[model samples]
Target: MTTMIKTVDVTTALSDVDRFCDIPNARISGEIFHRQDIYEQELEKVFARCWLFVAHESQFKKAGDYIATTMGEDDVIVVRQKDGSHRAFINACPHRGNKVCFSESGNARGFICNYHGWSFDIAGNLIGQHESGIYENSHFDASKWGLREVALIDSYKGLLFANFDADAPSLKEYLGPMAWYFDALFDNQEGGTEFVGGCIRSTMDCNWKIAAENFVGDILHAGWTHDSAARAMLGGAVAKVSDFDESYSVNWHGHGYEFAMDTVGNVAVLGESALNKYLHTIKPSVAERLGDFRSNMIGSVSSATIFPNFSFLPGQNTIRVWQPRGPNKIELYTWVLVNKSAPEEIKEKWRKGAMMTFSPTGVFEMDDGENWEYCTKTARGKVTAKQDLYVGLGQESLLQETDLPANVYSGQLNEANSRAFYQFWSDLLKAPSWNDVPNRNVGRVEAGAAAERCSLKEAK
Candidate 1:
């Protein structure tokens, strides 16, 4: 039974997308977090068109190793091919849309549908089907019945990303200015980085943007929101605000990074003496390789997000993807990363330290989960949903003397990156195609003009 639907004008729909976010004034309407219609459109515009983090290269050591993951609402299977490269595909069987891969992860030669016995090889080819000889139509081409492959798959350093839009820019180009900053975390050492422990999965009763916006540029919440956890982890002092604090909040193409110049602030929070010691020992070398700005960021009290939903902590080394479950829920997938050249003991310490601090039962995670839940739950109120949330912390604070790329602003407390994030998000929601989306980062920062606008010292 096919149902025909009449088309309605979406001009108003497109026009209203930017209304939820007032970037100039740094006010975000609560409705964007809870609206069903906007959430549905996000699936098509943001997740479907962006390069989303899917897996890590270390997860697949041998041929045929695979993991079942999600790209927005769609189930995807990322596989390690025999050629030492990677490939990903939609995890649904073409026969009747049944899921083809059941396990979360494992090494398998191929995927077989539990229903109808249709099977696909590791390369996503239709290799077998149940007893196909009887009354096979000439039109039934086995070659055409294969599982659908993802449009593109690529990696940055060791982290893998997949894109569903063939028209989308390549991962490197899409990463843009953010890629330069990524080197501060991923390229600090020569041996490169690898995921140590397997992924830890949990669910949060919060809008996906809520969690992402936190990592994007919400260090202000750290001092107050996680005060107890910080005390437990770092002994007496929490992430307190000081008049002389030197840090930066930066964003480009929607990606955000906020950090303190104090190199061991976050590393000390891990409560691992050896790990903290290790960072101090390597700080000089990292500085030589990546420069002072990036090297100082290596283990600083920093939080960053790569556009839509990929986030990580530099010193704590916890990488996460906030996979959207619905408008008001997100499935959080987390992993611990360490440099391959680091000592084995350090790797083990990081694995356990991250587990204690950021995992499901982690002290920090518990506090964050509860808060984001309340944030989402309260927004459902008719009156509350109409309220506007302020994100104008550092609206008057732009930096120019710094060598950091893209929109550089003052301190760990600023909401500049958060505002930029919402602006890009709104742009994506409204743009009809990639061509329509504007590159706001171009000419965003002119050193001489920015330096005269506001000094970091005066802003603080």
Candidate 2:
């Protein structure tokens, strides 16, 4: 017999958004991370309504190529058609609920359900049925039986995303000022960036937010947490890189940046000479494409989260999609990114760099995984679940109506990003539409002035 799990009343729990929002210096309520009811609520409020990253354009190159992916745990097949447009549909058969396409990815003219031979074209049109005679007078319409389509789908610099809610804002609008940083990476060159190959998949017993928060806000962990790995590679001079002595920027949509020293601790593996050579080689190209400001960012270490579940570490060149398996479990998919126009040798070096630092087997990823697991386990205890967690490190330093182009956080080690993330989370949970997100913190047009002053001071 199938077991039935209890459903959580997220609407009722969300009524206390202010309670969760008020405690900036403590852990969020432990119950929020592990409650079954809250997880279901997230499926509706967070997953269903938000734009979710699905696949890279590079994955579907051919006219009939397709890839099976997911958006908030719902299976979807992204297809490239002869008309040069892309489309996505729920991978379930219309006749029955069986998954129509099972392969992870490949070229295909159409999908034929293994269950009953029901087929759909590249555009998700019901083109063929095994038995049309039986349904001739049964009031069956092929058009009506097509695979269910996602309400919204779009691409930005080759990254494809979808949303189930029709009323959500355009993907570009949703990305907000964070696009400036992405332009530094994705649109740095003429052809833009592309996924080098398939992604690395892994699972962990921890709250998905823990992993997301680490990627978005935890710049403090690199030095001490990965100290052993950094020391082994650097011959014990990891402090030059991992020390959090830099500025922070928290964007309006909860996307944020931690700008720290260029000497990432992991680069110790490449040695100073090799590391210097690598930087020298990429510097001119980066400057030519993105100008001096972004070129300077090339060496800085960063951890960025795009709202709910998408995150990318541009310094490490790793793109991650976090799929929530439960309140306390997450399935992670990671991809390595490379400039499409980069030299083969440079691409290879970047790949090696990524594999050594960010993959499932990478030293830093393992360190992060351990902490996430421990945090989740502790939060699940009865006493712990009742208490609130803290995140108010830079609350006082938040420049609410600043002249910066982005929401600037004061310190590298501050929790401003985490706080912004939870703020958006609570807002999303309560608001009925994405349009309801307040435009209270849009940044000024002249953002880099303060950053430029700091750069000059450092030079002096």
Provide the clashing-pair count of each candidate structure: 0, 9
Q: Per-residue CA lDDT of candidate 2, range 299-350, in tens?
A: 5666788878988876567899889998888898999887788777766777
For each candidate, the alpha-carbon lDDT, in order, equals 0.84, 0.73
Top TM-score prediction, candidate number: 1
Local accuracy of candidate 1 as per-residue lDDT tens digits, 1-460 = 1011112122334558657688897799888889888898888788888889999898998999998999989999999989999988889988899999999999999999988888888988887788766417656777777888888889999999998887788887787766767788898999789999788999998999999999998998888878888898878876565442688888887899988887878878888999989998888888777666667778888899998999999999999999999999999999999999999999999999998999999989999999999999988998898788998888889876654557888877789999988999999888877777898866665423433333233234
Please list the residue runs of candidate 2 whose C-alpha ends up more than 4 Å from where it truly belongs after superposition. Answer: 1-13, 21-27, 240-246, 261-276, 399-403, 440-460
Query: Best-fitting candidate, measured by lDDT?
Result: 1
**Among all windows of ten consecutive residues in candidate 1, which has the lowest summed lDDT?**
1-10
For model 2 the TM-score comes to: 0.89
Clashes of 1: 0
State in Å the error of residue 274, model 2.
5.0
RMSD of 2: 5.2
